[model samples]
Target: MASDPEDRAAAQRELASLKFAQAQDKAKQDPAAAEKLVRESLTLAPGDEKAVDLLGRVIHAQGRLDEAIQVLGEGDGKSCDMCKRYLSVLLLERAGKREAAKDFEGARTDYSRATELIPDATTALAVARSSEQLGDLEGMTRAIEKAVPLIRPEDTAAQTEFLGFRERTVLAAAGRGDVATCDRWLNFFPPGAGGDGWYVLQLRVAQELYRQKKVDVAVTRARTMLGSTHTDTLPANRKTEFQRFLADIYRLQGVGYLREGKLAEADDNFRLAMEFLPGDDKIKLLRALAIGGHHETEKALQVVKALPKETKGHAEVMAILESMQVADRLAEGDVEGPRPRSRAQAASAETPEVHVAMAEILFITPAAGVNKGIVRQLKKSGIVKYPNDEVNRYGEALSELAWAREQARGLGEGYLFRGPGIDARMANLDRQLRAFTRSRSSSTPTARRS
Candidate 1:
């Protein structure tokens, strides 16, 4: 009676299919018209997967990405493979536009969604790029990992590009002290894939670790690389550079140990450093400092004196000599007056002799006792001569020690007299200075006496 219900349903389905076919043919040449036809087809058969896919494509072609995405999303509930493929493509296109506009956040959103849909190398790489722009190192690394497996063997260009990206990521990680990330990426490359550049990268990572003050870790990493057979494959210049880098690391460690009063360890590291950087006078000076740290003033003095008179660190060496002489004079209870005809008194001397003398006095003075004669000599040294200077006598002494320490550090000699003995003495002087400051603030100043 109702015009045959079955026949009516069949007619609607046939008409919908016919409209969808027409829409597909016109999709490329006239997307606007194609969109209208697909919409009419969907009106007749509301949930047709093919019809919905065609509508999305036509809408995307007409540059209505948001509408197209909305239309395509309708078929997702039906698990339409074709719809998902089209949607992923549309998303990639939109992502590209966003990226071109420098809207990386929007681009990242689209790229990430597309990656979840297709899991293809191209989309994954796009996600990686966007993540990099956002400073998302973890996201960038994850995307790269996803892409590497998807890359086809025949796609040599893609593989090379991935490797290059990985190399940059590793270096960036190293620079930021992300040791674990650097290690993971480094192991991703097969043996010999990174060539000599690989070894250089390792050295750079170790150097960065050192700069960040992770000294023990840096030493271990550098030592491991130094012992690797792969090192022999490096070019001569690169090998030399690596060797020198290792030497520098050892020297730095030696200086650290020397400053901490670990004489045996300091001497051992310095010797190891000398093996790589043979005849390095800086290392020799460091060894001498180690001797001095152990209170072997004569041995330290002889080592310094043995250096050529025209050494670049002549000023530092002279300071060391003065420091030792002061120590010797203090030990002999000879602080009655300044030593006669000393190198510091010479007209040609350029060393900060006053600072050196004060540093030595501070280095040798026990925490429980203060030498009045040394105090008188310090006052007479004129370290507190500036009227406008706010620091008292003890503060001036500490300042001189600090200046000497900085000079030594700049010359790669480590902090001068940073051993426990000197540290204790300096701490004691600091306490006294604080006490003196409080007293001066609350009471009349004592008469100035030398």
Candidate 2:
């Protein structure tokens, strides 16, 4: 649209007003207001590069990212190359067109051209990320090749940004399942390079090794990183990431123990897994372990209660907790006298089903009294059939115990039983006790001799 003289002067006044409004909007963190001002500025001077840039930023900040890209593209060739590079990345990333459109490579070209126009380390890092994304390993190597030479050794920003580029290159290599390339990148890390990046990279390497089934190597690498005295020096975000990695390690360790039938060790690892995961994730693990009679069910519930109501798994945990509470009230009714729980009591009954469940989960030991009677019966009779099957019998009994424990954890009526399982030794002892009492009362000579 062509502008008349008066129309052009009025447009200038509107542009000036919006410039003031933009500052006010930013100060208030009012994205809506900022967007409105930028849009009005663009309307007043439709082809104004500054107006387009400001509007594009406001739109991107508001997450109307596609619209931002369209607005920014108007100034794509005219704006400073640095601005174009940033805008291109936002466009490519928000469009989810990274590899599909080969935009990362285009971004690399822009950054490379920018360096020819103005040499800078930030541009070098951008080029490195772009090359890594494009699977141009040698290009990545070359992009950062200039970085170290350009950087003064003591330049913290350059060093930090270079480390960032190196870390990303490692991640890209790992993503491509190119462990050899990742190792080559690791060689560049300085000997004393202790930071958020080092521990994270170590954990990533360990994870890759674990994925390759190099279990012992993975364990050693994880422990070495975790046990480092400087772990405390890591940033909060990095420490959270480290804790998540530890949780994953513990989960794998738990699976190993569980497969070997080592219930105690499995339970320990799973409990540690819950401790490091977020509340929602922790509850899921707790529910699974609670069904298996791990001892941390009650503690897990307490932790879930502490989470914000908006947490992802909150509703599910609350439902399970409510069902458990009802079951507890039902079980306690006969033992604690005929009393109905009040609504408030029902809601917050911290009853101890999980505690009792844990106590009862252990293998039931045949006490001395029971064993003595069984041995006596075995010695006296032709009733001991299939004597070689004792170990098999014990295993069957333990399996039954495991099933009962699973049921008693309130796994619903599907697992609950109508009757107690048969205990062969106890049954034999009962039968022999009845026969011995009858003989003793009849003045049997065997009882008198004893």
Identify the candidate with maximal lDDT: 1
Off by over 4 Å in 2: 1-134, 142-146, 153-164, 186-194, 201-217, 229-232, 236-244, 259-450
Q: How far in Å is the alpha carbon of 137 misplaced in model 1?
A: 4.7
Alpha-carbon TM-score of each model against the true structure: 0.63, 0.33
Candidate 2, residue 324: lDDT: 41
Give me the candidate number with maximum TM-score. Answer: 1
Q: What residue pairs are clashing in model 1?
A: none
lDDT of 1 by residue, 1-450 (tens): 147886888888888889989999999999999988999999989978888788887888888898988777654424556788889888888899999999998998888888787788778888888888889988888888788778886766666767777778878887888999999777655223466767777878888898898888887887677676665676677767767887887877776776565779988998999998887887787777777766676787688788876765544655555555665577688876675226543422334433546754543334444466655654455333322232234555667767755654564545332332344444554565556445444442343431
lDDT scores in order:
0.70, 0.55
RMSD over all Cα atoms, model 1? 8.8
Give candidate 1's TM-score: 0.63
Model 2 pairs whose backbones collide: none
